[model samples]
Target: MSDTAARIADFIEPLRVAPGSKVRLGRDFDPRYRAGLKKREGVELLRTGVALLAEYQERLAAQDTYGVLLCLQALDAGGKDGTIRHVMSGVNPQGVKVSSFKVPSTEELDHDYLWRYARRLPSRGEIAIFNRSHYEEVLVVRVHPENLVRQKLPERARGKDVWERRYREINDWERYLTDNGFKVVKVFLNLSKEEQRVRFLKRIDLPEKNWKFSAADVRERRHWDAYQRAFSEMLSATSTPWAPWYVVPADRKWFARICTAAILAHTLMDIDPRYPEVSEEARNDLLAARQELEEEAPSGAAADPYAARTAEAKDEHGAGHGRPARKKHGRG
Candidate 1:
């Protein structure tokens, strides 16, 4: 790896939650961790990372053999939207799909918890970004058991151990995806309670951001300790070798976005997707097409005006021998 890349790798290493490791969120992960990067430096790194990410995305689409799923989970105002906007800004819109999961629709409630997410999985050669994802089943629902009642589970499925079962199920599902060509990348934007409070106040104070602050957000904030416990357990239980969770420091938006971009770029680097190689027949076909285009160029007008009148010819009767007159548009 280049020095820059090595530095990025080191920067994000601490964010990953190792599989089978116990997690005490406030004790272990620091929400303000910046990995020694200043604001301007982090922004510069993020810009570079986004460019590299775009190149990898183009190659990934051309390769057309693997897909990537980025699952982003966070509490209210944890900066999931900004992180997605910045981290994936440079990628092709055609190759990346961002799915932000809000409250479940009536139709969504009829299916399994993972069903909605399953239906939106990325096709080969594409990247899917899940803004909240199925992890909410454990995080939010676990925090508020009343929310679980809406799922309407059968008598057999209901138990104190249901969360544990869901964890195992999620781990297995992610493993299954990895067993195939799809890779699952999970990230949790770790925002401190105080930082979240500050952000919530900012939203309330700013007219432009007022719409982002909901009364429910403060209501949820009242359950901060409960949510933190849920997040801690969720991170500890669901993080696996196939789909480990990266707890990004979300207090500093610049550093968080930079770390998020670095982690994604590193994964693409590890995947090492490349543009597809052309076969001999395809190469010949490309060359033939190139030659045909060259023959119709303005440079060839001197040799055969009729054949090369492709640039800007205005003919009253049009070209003879079934050739059409050229009408140039802006760039053409």
Candidate 2:
């Protein structure tokens, strides 16, 4: 890694939630932290990280041994879409899959809460992005306990400790995935109340961004405090050694994108995926194929099909309709 990349990786170290460490969203992480980088510098760093990430992804795909799952959880107007777009812009689309989780469908509601998310996990050699992930079970469902009534849980299972139990289940699930060659990187876009308000207003005022605004977003904004508490608890409970949570400062979009891309690039470097090696026999076969190709008749000669057709046309049509004909020649 270059010095700049190394510095960026070091910068993101403090953003990761230490295993078993308790975190208060507002106090533990500052949403406006910019690592002293200006917008132009941050964007340049982000592009650099993304270029490195693209190389790492190609190796991961060729190796086909490990997969990466990036889970993004945030409040409304928290910049999840923007983060995914910018951070992953340089990666090969064939190796990445993005899934946005919204309200559960009727079929999804019938199953356990984690079922839908489990089905979306990354396959080997792929990167899967979760826009709003399984953490919603703890965030949204915790904030609005009434939403759990439709889950068809046993009455006794809806006790005050339900969120705690769910947290444990999620941790265990993530650990299991890690053990099975899937690494999870969970990120929370920590947007401040004032910043979110400004972004929401932008959505309303900008003609092209009007579609992003919704009355539901305003209703959810009212429970920001509750959501923050839930996020704090979730981060504390599930930030394990295997699947660490990154609390990215999202007030400045450029800074946040740089942080996220740097973290992901560092993770991929740590995984150290490599292209699969070819065996001696396969190498010999490739050499043989190359010799055969080199021994073939030179291109544009009579042995070449397209060349033969052109020669026949020249012989029949006298080379050109409007120009003088030239003497026939062998391949140059």
The numbered model that scores best in lDDT is 2
Candidate 1 global TM-score: 0.88
TM-score of each: 0.88, 0.88
**Candidate 2 CA-lDDT value:** 0.90
Which run of 10 residues does model 2 get worst, by summed lDDT?
299-308
Per-candidate Cα lDDT values, in order, are 0.88, 0.90
TM-score of 2: 0.88
Off by over 4 Å in 2: 1-6, 297-332
